[model samples]
Target chain A: MRLPRARGPLTERLVACLQRPPRSHVALARTDGRDAADDALALWILHELHYRGFEDVDDAWEWAPSLMSMRHHLERELEERLRAEYSRSEGSRSGQAGGDEDVVAVLHQLIEADDGPSLADHLLRDGTTEQACQLLRQRSVYHLKEADPTAWVVPRVVGRAKAALMEIQYDEYGAGHHDRVHQDLFAHGLAAAGLSADYGHYVDEARLPILEQNNALSLFGLQRRLRGAALGHFAAFEATSSLPSRTLARALRRLGLPDEMAAYYDEHVEADAAHEQVALRDVCAVLVADEPHLREDVLFGAWACLELEARTARDLLDHWAAA
Target chain B: MAVEEPDVRPAGDGPLRCRPCPGGPLLVRGAAQVQGDDGTWHDTTRPVTAVCRCGASALRPWCDGTHKVLSQRGVNPIE
Candidate 1:
């Protein structure tokens, strides 16, 4: 996962600057980015500095004042875009519970009302082997480090929300079995599928929507101000995963993909069922209960999850249809 | 004479908590094992587990979220 190719002036300067040492007073261009993909990839690279960094990059850059300022700018733009996109859709504020309506129930309502293009259903019904392979390639950008982004929410929460979140995270970290860690399991699946299992391997080829989805997770999790949204995003992710995972497993097998790849989704079928329960009833609900003011932020985060995913699904399906 | 409640408290600071989630599975924690539908003792794998209540899961005794699908179709458990 060396620096991906520059998609625009922002990433072009970012990629070049990242290659050299983080010297003081290095001025970056003031452009927002060339296009949506360009902005997404540039922000993605900036976020990558916080994660396991690219080769030959200085660890100190993770907290460099200049880099942090640049990230703050990109993050603000991305956040504004996500909020505007979500609000522009029908009844965006409907996710907010009315007059003591249960937050968890409202989360369910948000999930149920989502009418996004179902990529899993497409794969199960009509996707070709090539489409499945391409999906897997794009998914590698996140699956290789599954569940890590959400871990940042730990210190920011407390009581039952914190405890419940730990329960979910511990299982994701694999319930005391090295062989069961979700990230490693996905790596095995990727290897079995004949794809590169290395972390950030497909980032260079990832579509803009994929980059946006990953960036949203990083943005929500890393910001203490957005902690409510982070948990909201996490809850939506888990609640929506189980049944679709069942569909994806069948789809992968139907496309004649390797069993190990399907096995990864098989694990999610049961795992996400439990994870969703804890996430909604315990994490999100309790967090909102303990602090009642975050109800809107929680809904906003959940909406971001659904809307961004809808965009990604539409992008891929439309691309395939066009081809 | 008291029958002693079988000393069923878990090995931790408290008794096992088995919470029946409305319209979902039974979320249980701090249990060492559970009796499956077939009467075999199944070791609880994680600290928290969801035991199937909808009876529609292919993975018996453990939920795979089949209840949500059932609810969507207006299907309710008879038992």
Candidate 2:
């Protein structure tokens, strides 16, 4: 949690600013280097302040306006890059209705037609321990605080949708059992695998795509305008999580890790399966049923989830293959 | 050493039998059991039920084809 080593000038300057008292306004001049390099790390650090602040940095810096401004600049650049990289198609727009069709059906089509590169396949079939560890590191950025991003949607939903979210979140929070919380469980997995369980330990090593994935959640969650998107995001995540968790468990077992080490994934295998129904039928369906207007935003949330994840998967797999 | 009670109820069909209730059929494909709000187990006597192998299915104690999707997508753990 100590401030990670500066990857480039952006991080170098940001880190220096963070070490001091919070300022009302500070400007970060744009850098021409690749977005994935130093800018990503710097932006990730800014976002990380909202979670567990860096161990060495002042906690007050979490609310610093100057830091916020700098972070915004980096985020703007990252968003522009992402929009340029992926094009939206009309077929992808099929779920944009506030009509009578079940949102789950639309989600199913999205899942069925997704031809995105398979990170899970590679991990289960042939990933080396080094590569697996790297994947875990990138994921640890979020899994260490699992469910927190989606928690933002709780206040945004009501009645059945709110109740359904609480039911699913209760399990994610381990139902008042600290040891059973999903985030803690993930930490155990990380520790068992010999990786650092401390928050943001690998931020320095994480590339832009990984950072961007987490940033998307924060982006959707923090905005009242994107509440529908947040719900859709959670639905997509829960809907898609079960099989990958099972595969991750198997991959860990294949590598000869103990059952305890695989317990996190094992838990997800049961938890998310049940969650999918609640998410699809009770949560997303009910939310759309009530709001009607958020159908498009919800679908966008789901699509964004898939898009960012695909990019992260491609980035990791491509790097691993090259290595 | 303390021993754990075996919940090995047989899935009754031919030789398969429910462990707890000797005459009761073993729970398997097409059959489901739901734990009610009061924690009572209720048998769902449907002809074809989707079973969850993936832990993510929200209708716990019930299969919903999520595991199949995960497997077909090559995201199943055994892959």
Candidate 3:
């Protein structure tokens, strides 16, 4: 988690500023159309401070006003890009779909309509060991702390939604068993695959799309206004996870890896299948049914999850193909 | 019981020869073993196989791409 190697000017300056005490007026401007690797990783590092600060960077930088302001600017740019990419629908769904009927039906429609290519299939069928390793590295950003993002919504939601979310998160946390927790399982997977299990070990090597995917969850989870979206995001994730996890497990085994090496994916193959029903039914459906207004935001959250995942999949597949 | 070493032979030409599951109608090509319902097992050397990840595949322990459709719809089977 030490400060990653700088990608370009933005990261270089940002990393330098982080090394010292936060400055009040550090220039935060960036030119347009710069290599995404440069900008996105830099932004990711700033965001990472909020999660697990780099090994070399001082912990004080997490709340430093200057660092926060710099991160704010980058986030604004990222948000603008996201807005341009994702158009809000003019449907009757409420901004806060707090009702049951609206949440389940809308979430179902959203899940049904997702037609993206299967990253799991590609991994199961043709993934090389190197590619799988890279995939784990990119995913380490979020998988290392799997359920924390949605946990942000626990207090923001009420009644059934809150209860349902807690129920799902309880399983995500291994129901009080530390070894069974998703994050720990992922770390174990990393170690079994001969990669670093220490958190944030792969920050410097990860691409922009990967960072953006994790950032979306963090963004929605931290903002109270986006609570419905956060629910939608989690719902979409659980719904789509089971088969992919199974495929990934097969892929790992194909590479002569042991069951422990495939433990993370194997665990998800079962866990997410049940989670899908709970998310769509108890969590989303109940929330929307009660609120009745946040349907579109719910769909928006689901779509954003799909869109980001699609981008990540395309990027990883393309990189592997090129290599 | 002690583990026995798998029989290895020189490659012959015929679709890169794979080991068929002894307990079911499944083919696997990799360095792994699949145990069947009758307590029999087969070792495979093929580089790839469609093992069933979902317990419900009509073709038990062999992938028939059923997971593809299920995943696209975001249906969690564990539930």
Candidate 4:
């Protein structure tokens, strides 16, 4: 995919910098920190450098030091913002997980206690086609590359955790069947919906929340220090997916959208049921056992996942309401 | 026509290990085929599969995570 239309000074500079050859001291764009779009888009582009590089950009730019400096700057800001939000969301509860607490139990409690807004519930109840399609576009930012962000944790972990992660990932990657791969299924869904099936097809139209959500996963996955958080976030994601996926499947059928697109959710309804059990019990629990110090980070990561999703839901719902 | 019947379960001594999740479904591994509620053998598809013990699942044999809503056990079903 080509670079998305630049959103601000940062992305504008990034778009231009990619056109040049590998350099040591290219000037990078700076943000005032208040505008999330400028920073989020810049960070998203930088993160993309590590994933599938843009068709137009030189691949050599990925390892350039100057770009790494820029990535670090944006990441620091993003991590700080995420940490603060996690803290604020904790408000009254004894925010920290006890060192000796059962990791799976804590994970279940963390996921169970979450009361965030449900986009699927809304789509199931009274969502219009416009709203549902809007949601599909927003979600494509991540679903198109599902399970990829968490794959980075494989190398960062060892012992049962690593093996357990692969056990879940095997199913996620279609268990050796290319046709069942989650990413391709989502691409098929996009095409069936009459939307673009290309990777990052709607990046240009992605809102601040969507970009930030993508950036958050990239940050956690790319940084070795955040492996616990990465797995935690993944557990939260899988744990919540099964039921909502069923709701979404019914919602899509109700709206008369193509059955092919709804079938993607139908697959998740069953897949995630098995995945959720293994993700929490085998992966996250084992990771915490191997490295007990990461327990809090796991909890924080789960919280961040829910928090970011809630923000995205609010942003889209509010936008739709206003429109 | 007396023909010898062949074994249909997963080959080797790899036992079909199953774990029951608290307030959730029974997770089964290494099963080539499973008997559904109607007593028909359905081919298992994934490396690991969730069998709906709660019986509230729309998917019948496979768990759709409806146990969470049945006994108020796991993630609350509705918003």
Model 1 clashing-pair count: 0
Tens-digit per-residue lDDT, A1-323, candidate 1: 68888888878888888888777666785755247788789889888888899986777777777787778888999999888877776536675335478988888888988999999999999999999999998888988889989999999999999999999999999988999999999999989989889998888889989999999999998999899999999999999998899999999999999999999999998888888999999999999989888888898888888888898999999999999
Candidate 3 local accuracy as lDDT? 0.70
Pick by DockQ: which candidate is best? Answer: 4
Which digits, one per residue and each the tens of the lDDT, describe model 4 over residues A1-323? 99899887777888988988878898775744446788899899999888888999999988888898889988999998788877776521433644476888777777777887889999989799988888888889888988888888889999888877888899989999999999889889889999988999889889888898899999999999999889888998999999999999999999888988999999999999998999899988888878888887888888888888888989988887889
Work out the iRMS of candidate 4. Answer: 0.5
Q: Residues A219-291, candidate 3, lDDT per residue (tens digit)?
A: 7787787887788889999877877777888888887765776888877765665566567766877777776
TM-score of chain A of 3: 0.90
Report the C-alpha displacement of residue A107, candidate 4, in angstroms.
Answer: 1.4
Compare candidates 3 and 4 on DockQ and give the better one: 4
Candidate that beats the other on DockQ, 1 or 4, i.e. the better one: 4
Q: After superposition, how far is residue A130 of candidate 4 from its true place, in Å?
A: 1.5
How well does candidate 1 reproduce the true complex, by DockQ?
Answer: 0.62
For model 1 chain B, the run of ten residues with the poorest summed lDDT: B1-10
Interface RMSD, all candidates in order, equals 0.9, 10.0, 12.0, 0.5
Ordered from best to worst TM-score, the candidate numbers read 1, 4, 2, 3
Q: What is the interface RMSD of candidate 3, in Å?
A: 12.0
- By TM-score, how accurate is candidate 3? 0.76
Runs of candidate 1 exceeding 4 Å displacement? A32-34, A96-99, B1-15
RMSD of 2: 8.9
In model 1, the Cα lDDT at residue A187 comes to 93
Off by over 4 Å in 4: A29-34, A91-99, B1-14, B73-79
What's the lDDT for all of these models?
0.85, 0.70, 0.70, 0.83
